[model samples]
Target chain A: EAGVTQFPSHSVIEKGQTVTLRCDPISGHDNLYWYRRVMGKEIKFLLHFVKESKQDESGMPNNRFLAERTGGTYSTLKVQPAELEDSGVYFCASSQVGAPDTQYFGPGTRLTVL
Target chain B: SQQGEEDPQALSIQEGENATMNCSYKTSINNLQWYRQNSGRGLVHLILIRSNEREKHSGRLRVTLDTSKKSSSLLITASRAADTASYFCAAPALSNTGKLIFGQGTTLQVKP
Candidate 1:
């Protein structure tokens, strides 16, 4: 089975620009999660989705960040008016509903906001 | 606030030697998981030890969990250059939720 996959392995944009990162989870997996790691900081959870509905979003940093999972297939995270501090690696992970603890991660998208 | 914290921010060892990394968490958890990440790469799940289990092994990897102490350790025996990576320990933020709280990670470099 294919593991989680993300798009645009790297992205460069200016501050105040909008960027969207996409993630396609493994086939038949119902759980999808988003995490971000800023330089010199630990990886932090952003949000989680079970099917098309969000399971938890308490980790979302602010109102400018938005995440959606449509049709319970793929997920997209949008950062509007990106700031310099938003530059970091964004990782997408997936796991089976029955086994949510062992997540498989994607290659991650490196976003640089200048 | 991160739930887990790994000790020894970095380590260097020669191949064929043993590498041990420790992690401690603040809250209760059903299980603890270890993951490895090569530079600029995503994380790869290594092992998971439940609260009730004291030890588990997979090939050259050995994981021990002490629920009473809220600590865990990962041991890689006869390490190879390929084992060089950043190791992270994660636990669920809540026993019923899948949200994972991660540690700062320990960078291990194994010389051939």
Candidate 2:
């Protein structure tokens, strides 16, 4: 089976512009999650989705950051009016229902906001 | 805030040498996990040790968790150049919400 995949391996956007990152989880997986890693910083959790429902979003940085998983098979994270601090590698992970911790990660989307 | 902190921010060892890195966390955790990230790549899950378990091994990798001290260590035996990468330890928040807080990470370099 194919591993998790992300779109636009790298993105460069203006500070005030809006950017949307996409993630397609592995087939037959029910749990999907988002995480970010700023330069010289640890990877931080952003949010998590259980199928079509968001299980946890307390880690989301702010209102400007919106994540959606309409059909549950895929997810989209949009950062509106991006700021310089938003520049970082955004990672997507997935896991089966039985084992929630053995998450498989996707090659992150490196977002650079100028 | 980051949940764990890895010691010896960086390490360099010759191939065939054993490489060990330690991680210390503050809160109670349901389980602790180790992950490896190659440059420009995603984080790959290495091993997971439940709070009650003290030691676990997979192939050449050995992981030990000491809940009493709230610390864990990862040891890669007979390391190879391919073992060079950044290692991170992560744990779910105190709430156990399926989200993980990662450590600062230890960058390991195994020179051939």
Candidate 2 lDDT, tens digit per residue, A28-104? 88999999999878899999999999999988999999999998899999999899999999999999878787889
Q: What is the lDDT of residue A113 in candidate 1?
A: 98
Model 2: what is its DockQ? 0.80
Model 1 ranges with Cα > 4 A deviation: none
Question: RMSD per prediction, one decimal?
Answer: 1.2, 1.4
lDDT of candidate model 2 versus the reference: 0.93
DockQ, cand. 1? 0.83
Residue A112 of candidate 1: its Cα lDDT? 98
Candidate 2 chain B weakest lDDT stretch, 10 residues: B92-101
- TM-score of every candidate: 0.96, 0.94
Candidate 2, residue A72: the lDDT equals 86
Off by over 4 Å in 2: none
Q: What tens digits encode model 2's per-residue C-alpha lDDT throughout B23-74?
A: 9999999999999998888889999999999999999999999999999999
Instruction: Please state the i-RMS of candidate 1.
Output: 0.8
DockQ-based class of model 1: high
Kept native contacts, as fractions per model, are: 0.83, 0.80
lDDT of 1 at A28: 93
